[model samples]
Target: MKVFEPVVRLMNRLKYAQKFIVIAVVFVLVIASVSFILMQRMNSEITEMEQRYEGASYNTALKDVLQQVQIHRGTSVQAWNGSEDAQSKLASIREQANRALHVLNEQHTKQTYPLHIDEELDAINEQWQAIAEKDRWQDRDELTTLHTNLTTFIIETMLTVSNESSLQLARSPASQNLIATLTKTMPSVTENAGNLRWLGASVLAKEGDMTAQERAHISEKFYLMIEEFATIDADLQRAFTDPDIQAAVQSTYEEATAANELYATMVEQLLNGETANLTSAAFFEAATNTINLQFDLYSTSLAHLTTLMEQQLSELKMNRIMLVLLETLIVLVAMYLFMGFYIGIKRSITTIEQAAISIAEGDLTTSIHLHTKDEMLEIEHAFNKMTTGLQSLVKEIGESSQYVTASSEELHVGVEETTKSIMHVAEMMSDVSEGANEQTARLQQSEDALQHMTNDVAQIVTNSEDVAQLALTTMTLAHDGNDVMQQSSTQMNTIQQSVETTQHMIEALHGRSEQITHILQLITGVAEQTNLLSLNASIEAARAGEYGKGFAVVANEVGKLAAEARNAAHEVGTLVQGIQKDTTTSVQLMGDVTTQVRTGMDLSTTTAQKFEQIVSSMEQLSEQINGIIVNSSQVASSTEQVVTAIDAMKVISTKNMAASTEVATATEQQNASMEEMAASATELATMSETLQTLIQRFKV
Candidate 1:
């Protein structure tokens, strides 16, 4: 850096034309360099965007593959679990699987197929054909294991493709989450649902005959489901960080969550040994719906991500186009300015040349003129100025010699007048010396008195300033007290509101207690009516003598219960009355408290207003004290200025007396200078002749 410092110094010494070429060259280099960088970046981005679009397509295809395989596997197991139309359902699912497989192969061919996705998919297909072989299918456990392995390979291949594509390294963070939901998380979630489908179908078909192994299978699936439930939420939440993506997938996410919840409830019931209540077909249908909803979520996320990448690709292309346009426009504008600068330089140079040749031939009137709005115009200005200065210098030199001759003549006449005036001033000087000493002595006495008065005024100003400071401090304290009073007023208001609220509550409680007492009274009346009816029934039965004994026993028990009911009702009425009385008393006390709180609030508010008034009055008092301090300060300052002026005037008077004596002594010397002035006049005339010959050489 220190070595570069000398280079910087050398650069600063470069001519303006050299600096312009340096700047133009740097501008071209910068434009080229930036354009090259931007082009390369755009090319990279376009290529990545195309790759991500392919990845999204591939992800969709793989998801469909999982959906088909999972569906067909569940259907085949459901058929094995005694589902109706076993062969037809398997054939239908097989056809759909074949179609999805065709699309998946096509998408696979579009990509480079890293991670041997081609061979792995073939292996999965071969295994899927093997699993779907119903004649070879043994138990649900063996079939589930086979289907799980096939789907697991498909998911792993999807993840590998994800890593190889732009999805794993997305420029937008939302894209990463969206891609994950399509690739890894949702695939695993659907696979677990698939596992539940086969296991649950067989278990529900068997009803209560599910073995411990079946329950353990259901529990493990549920455990994985629980973990996935949390992961899907976290992934979607991260994906929703972008507003546009959130809006795109919000509907599918809700539907998927609802379906997952429904399926989870069914799975939980099965795990809890409640499978006898669920039919095999219903359980299979619920699992299928859960799997379909998860796929929907995957599809929605992928489509929106694809749309975003397409837009990004378009924007990058447009940016590249704009960059080219901008660079070309800059070059055009730079060329325009460069041409203008060259033309201005040419005009300025031509003007300078003509002016220079004229000046070289002894023409002082030669001058350059320009109106360029550039640095080259400065040269025009400088050239014209030099010629004008030269012309003016010659004219001034010619006139200066004549002025010298005339001044010498004037000086000789001025000396005689000065000798006369000096003799007259000497007479006045003696009189002035007497008055000057007396004025100086009086000024000194006045200054001493002013100094004492100034000190007293200054002390008064200081005391007034201290009083003003105290008043300002008091004003601040009054404002603080006002704030405290305001807060107290607000608190009292809050308390008043609370008291009123409590009073209303107590009044309601008292009313409710009175209503309870009425209800208790009604219960006592009803018990009496029942006792009367029971006695009437016993009398009627006695007329039929054999039935009378049974009727009499019943009536006696009924009467006893009625009597107890009446006694309890009476006791309850007594308690209700007590509660009513207490509540009424509480309500009345609360009313009194409310009134007191309101009064306190009013008083506090009034006191706060008074505090504000006190603060205002203190502020006015502080301002009045400040005004008095300012007046006292002004009085002290004026007294100091008067004292200083008197001291300066005294010094001036003493100097004037000395100057008068010096003037009288110089008058004799002026009488001798009259002869010298005559001799200088002779020399000035000779210099004037020489200056006239020099001025004749210039045209000015």
Candidate 2:
């Protein structure tokens, strides 16, 4: 069992084409075997039929010849005792007997008879020739012995023929039935012939010595035999079809009818007690001879008919055997050619399938080899071409993958450097934001000092209504206000420059974010292309069906990877979009900061101008101090106006500080956005590196 296991496995692994070839070969072999067996059986049947036919023909011819000889002997005896007309009748019977013997000999010569039967026939012929050559019949006893021997030989031959007929009939029912009918009628004819012979012998007895009762008994027997013979004759005439056999039967019936008429006339004379002109010996001889001749002719005709039938059956059997053999030969030849063509196709298909399997297993290097000029050869060529194309495609893919890996590595490095640059820019933005916050604090302190200076000016102006004293204090406060305004202008200019720098940085960040978005778009395109390739692979796998099931699994994994890449790209796209949105917001905030810085600078210029106006007004107040006592009421009003102006300047400083604080907040938001952008870029770089690594796994 173990030894055969590998053989069984090998058979199981046979390609469909090989399996089909095996099945077709087996089928043809089975048909050929069956046909051979049938041919053998038919040959056997033909042989058996030939044997039966030969036996029946030989026996029938022998039987006919014997019966003819018996008739001829009876006619010779009739001629020896009968009237003048009897000689001619004897001559006719002798001619008929000779003719029948000639026909029997002719038939024997034509057929290849069995050795044993031929020996028997030769002996009979020799005996018949010896008897025929005798000059005279010595005694009744000797004639009777000769007749008995002939009868015995005829009976034995008939029995042998009957046995052969029986076997032949067992094989064929139609022939059996026809032959059976003829055999059934034969016994009645034989009995009638024997009775007729007895009647002839009784009639030849001395006329005076014969009793009336004996005459009547003989007449009655004769009438009965004649009636039976007439009936059998009618049957034969109706049943027999062969021209020679029918003619013989008809002639026999005529002779028997003539003999019956003659015997009836003799009986009529005996009954009437009239002197019959005919001699009893001559009348008896003539009647018995005619009756014997009629009986012999009937038997001979029947035997001849049976011989013909057997000959026909034998011919038909031979023809059938020939036909069967011819058909079998044709079938065998056709099957042989079919098997050859089948094997050729099987070889071609097997070669193609092996090539297909090798290709399926990723052995694109394996070459397909097939020798034919048919469709299978075309398929082989196509298969080789397909393998070559696949090899080239794989080679190209391997090279492209190497290039892609190198390019991705370079891109990863570039992205990493860009990320670091973005991080540094973010840190610088953070510091700029901190400086803006400090500037805002200094502005707030300056606003508080201006408020204290405004309150002190209001108190001094109220206390000093004298012109000189009021002018001196107001001039000192004006000088201090000019210094404070100059300092606030300087701080505002510094803040404006910072805002401009922050705006410029935000613009650069926005441009970088746009670039990142473009890169994300490229990544998305790559993912889409990968997905498309995976889909194409899936389609090819589906086309390959069961053979590509393993490849289908690989394609499915590739599809999953493509889906993962697409998802990653989508995530990157989302992150880039977030960065873009943040960048846009930062640009808007920077623009707002720029606008606030400009407003703060304008406010600082207005405050500096107000400080100049205060200094000029202080100088005018010192020059007009002599007239102060006269315009004490006006000075007091002017001091109140100065206090109001100081309060308004403090409000302007407070707004400038708030604007600076908002700028600082906007800068901080921008810095955070830049940081996020840098992180996103770093992530994108990592993803690109991962993509390159994954691509590296596919070797051409």
Candidate 3:
């Protein structure tokens, strides 16, 4: 089979690229799945942390402390006049202050450090107890000194608490300034409150010396100054004693100290006035401002902290946005890399697919050439080698086929020549058989004429004895005729010589025909053997296939020649039988003629013995002579019949010769036809070989 170069080449090209595509696809899928899962888990943790920072429990603790400080300032003013309303208000202030202090103490108990400002606040409460003891009983001048002292005490005490708060709220510059300014202004506020009280007492004593209008004007101015001082003092007191204020201050102090300690700890946390710190006073102050920013300088601190929390939240949001952007960029880069790998793999697969298709279509010359130093390149090399081997094998097969064709042609020619020789031998045998048939016919005729002559002589001897008896009768009549005896003797002598010459001619013809018959038998046997040889040649010719078609034709001609020879042998046998019948008839006719001649001889001898009695036998002797003449004439007619049969036998022999010549000519013509057929068969075989050669170009 011829291999197509294109098909083999195509097969070689596809084998390497397939493996690369499979590995690249699997790698991309695995990497993408893991990345997606990790990003999702991180996002969930971020959401949970944000919710904890925004809860409301921290908001409520800041408001309660500010309300209690407001109540205590109101009660102290009423206690100085000694009114029942003043005492009741004073008791209420004491109870609420105690409650507020207990709450502050509870907050401090949970702290890691002490808040020293709580001791200053406790001393201020003891001064309110001194105002309760001497209410309305003391003289004006004495009352004046007590009022001045109480006011001074309240001023100094609040200044000390504010200074302490200033140290704790140090992280924010605004909270530090608010704490320092309140401490500096406290002494002036205390001195002015004392001047207003003294003015009010003087105006009440001098009302008789002035006009009503003048007294009213002085009195109203004095009262107005006193109200302004009281209002300032009450606000200060409220801010100080307020539970939210204390808690904010206490929580701030604890966190500030914790931070200082944390600086030396393994990890540090931001302190109280550090904006947006979760566990700090600034954290609680931002919550407290939402409730109590009406009268206190603490409101400024609350606003500043609120501003800082907003900025921190905004920055955190921006950081989250930047992280998301970075993650997106990384994913995009990974996707691009994956896409490049996929495209490269797909291109290789396409090349291989094309090569495979070409190979299937019978293009064996193409090669799978690859540049990579990988398994695919190795496969390509092997594929190329396979195609090279196939090309060589196909070429060798074509050469061997041509050699076989030439050898077959030579064998066919030899077989044809052998067949022709066998045919020639058969023709020669037929000619010989025809000649033998003619010879056998001539022999039969000769034998028949000889037998006739012998039978005729025996009949003549029998008649001679009859004639001797007749002579005795003639002697009895011898006294009557002597002329009759002389004529009879002459006739008998002529008849005897004719019978002896006829016998000699018959013997010569028989001997010549017997020799011809022996030769004919020899020729018949030779023809039969020749026929057998021709048959064998035909069998060999038939075995030679298309190459020996010429020889087969010649073998057929030989078979025909052999059949002709067989016919010739049968014709000769039939002619020999006819001749034997004719010879028997001729022998019977000669026997009759010979017998008459002998009888005539006997009549002549008897007549000579009876010569003395001739006078009496002369008339009988003339009759006997007439009988001898009749017998001699019959013998001559039989000899003419024998000569005519010999002439007929010679004509049959001539016809047999013509038939043999025609057979010989026909055999020669058959041999020529076989030669022509052999030539034609050779031409056909050559044509077939040429066709085969042309077909070899198509590699199969």
Candidate 4:
């Protein structure tokens, strides 16, 4: 992570386009650089192997020339020494050698060789041509010398070609040394072994005691052949040490050495002055066998070397192919990772941009979401927190605002209803006042009628004057007082009935308040449901993505508004409960006022019953006018009690007035309280509207 910190910082500073460009440039540079190095190496390897392979063909051409020339050497020696079979074979063998020379010449013409090897090849070919052109037999030793010299040139050319073409070189030590043995060491051994064959056959053909110079030549060739075999053996030993060397190389080499040892034993006869047992042909045959086996070793080694080079060339080609593919894969993978990272970063940035824009537009309900597991996830979380808090605060403010508006309206309506009730109660109080005054006047009339009755009774008792007229007057006044008292009772009863009806109406209003409160609760529940539905819509729209982005935003705003509405409904429900409580209190107060009205009605009824008794007493007084004259003092006492009853009625009427005044005062206070509540509600409503105006700025 720390290793990538610089890249991270650079990437953070760069825009997405700049980052993409940087990554693309770096990717191309790295891949191109690595590919160039590997391709150069592979090309060099392929070229070297191809050259070596091409040189193998030249070497084979040289080997063909060497083969015929080696045979040519032996036949020339035999023919010069007077072997009829050798003389017969000599011309055809020369032709074969010449044909091989022609083929090698053709090969040389097609491709240029190294200056040294090419010159050596031309000289070798010219010497072979000169030898083939000489048809007449020369001295045996001279002819052998010509053939030996030409064959030596051919072998040398082969070695030069091997060296020039890098056939003697290989990748590993064992293989390198092995190829050296085949191309350089084994070729020399085979040629020297051919030398022994010819020299020894010449000695056998002479059939005389070997001359000192000839014997010396035979001794040197035999030992040189032995020494070269030793060198080849050592080289082969080294080659076999490699684990990968063929087991057949060791087996074939052992067979060649066996043949060489046999030939060495035969050559000992020519060296030790025992030429009787060995004929020229037998000596030649034995020596040729040794050369052939040595040639077999050369051939096997060459094949192995060629195979090794081919495998090396194949491996190099495969490596080049693999390197190309690997480079391609590296490029593809690098591009994939960079593009994925780029796309991921781009997507994250887009998301952040959208969320920020939404917030800028006052859409607090828009929450940030990210799918990638990166630093952007932290940013998304932070954004979500910010939006969620803002949304909650706005929702609370809106809810409070709507609650205030509703409460204000409810308060205003309550004030109006309460003011009307106060006015109705005031009208009822005015009626009670008039009824009280009417009752007071009636009481005064009864007092005057009693005064007249007393005067009439005094006249009847003192002067025995008009007893029947006084009795009739007393009865008529009693009837009139009874009727007035009944009228007063009827008015009082009407007041009591009005109070009971007002109480019942107030109670009914309380019941209606309770029902209204229940309906408000239902509306509050509906608001909550609306909030829930908005939330569900928002969820669905979020799931819908591109198709529903606008819908999701709308739903989110709706959900917030619904939350506000639900809260407002709850607050209004609370206000309605308060109103309900007030209504219940008003009903209770009306009950109390109704009870007072009933008490006043009972007092009026008692006064009416007293008048009825006074009327009955008047009826009995007609029969007893004398008795009426004597009980006139009792009547005056009864009139005094009646006046005391009227005073009590006046006191009841005063209390009713005072009670009515208290009721009016209380209603006024309630009205004023409602008025204050309405003012507060209006102010709250204004604040609600202000909050709503601000909230509307946010789309969600």
Candidate 2 pairs with clashing backbones = none
Candidate 1: stretches off by over 4 Å: 1-22, 38-46, 82-84, 112-142, 166-178, 353-366, 386-700
lDDT of 2 at 267: 51
| Model 4 lDDT tens row, 1-700 | 8999998999999889898988799879977987898798789878778677667777767777777788888877777777899889988887887787788878777764442566787688778778888877557666767877877777777777777777666778888778777677666776777777777887777784577887788788778888888888888888888866757587788888899888988888678877778888998998888887777777777767777778888999999899889889988898898888888888888987787676656676787678868888887776676566556645654564566457546645754565566457556655655665665576567656656655665666665567666667767877887787788678777767766665565555456446545545654564565466557656655543454465466557656655665565566556556655655665666566566657656766776776677677778777766676667667666666666666666666566555555545554554454455445445545544654676677654
- Find the candidate with the highest lDDT and give its number: 4
- Could you tell me how far off, in angstroms, the CA of residue 252 lies in candidate 1 after the best superposition? 2.1
Ranking by TM-score: 2, 4, 1, 3
Expressed as tens digits, the lDDT of each residue in 1-700 for candidate 2 is 8999976887789865576567666776876787678767766666666655665565556555655555555545445544355456755665665676676677667765343445555666666666666656776446545654754565555555556544335333433433443444343344344434433444453443456765676567566656765665565554454455555466665776677566656655654555356455665555556555554554565565556657766676776677667767876787687678878877776776676676566666776677778787776676666556545544543443343344344444544554554455455455545545555555555555455545545554454454456466656766775676677567667756765665676567567656656665665565566566556656655655555565456556555654665565566556556655665666676576667656666766776676677667668767765554454455445445544544554454445445445544544554454455445544544544554454344332
**Alpha-carbon error at 530 in model 2, in Å?**
4.3
Clashes of 3: 52
Superposed on all Cα atoms, the candidates' RMSDs to the truth, in angstroms, are 55.7, 11.2, 26.3, 12.6
lDDT-best of 3 and 4: 4
Instruction: List TM-scores for all candidates, in order.
Output: 0.50, 0.57, 0.32, 0.56
lDDT of 3 by residue, 50-106 (tens): 321121111111212323333333233323433356457656655665565456445
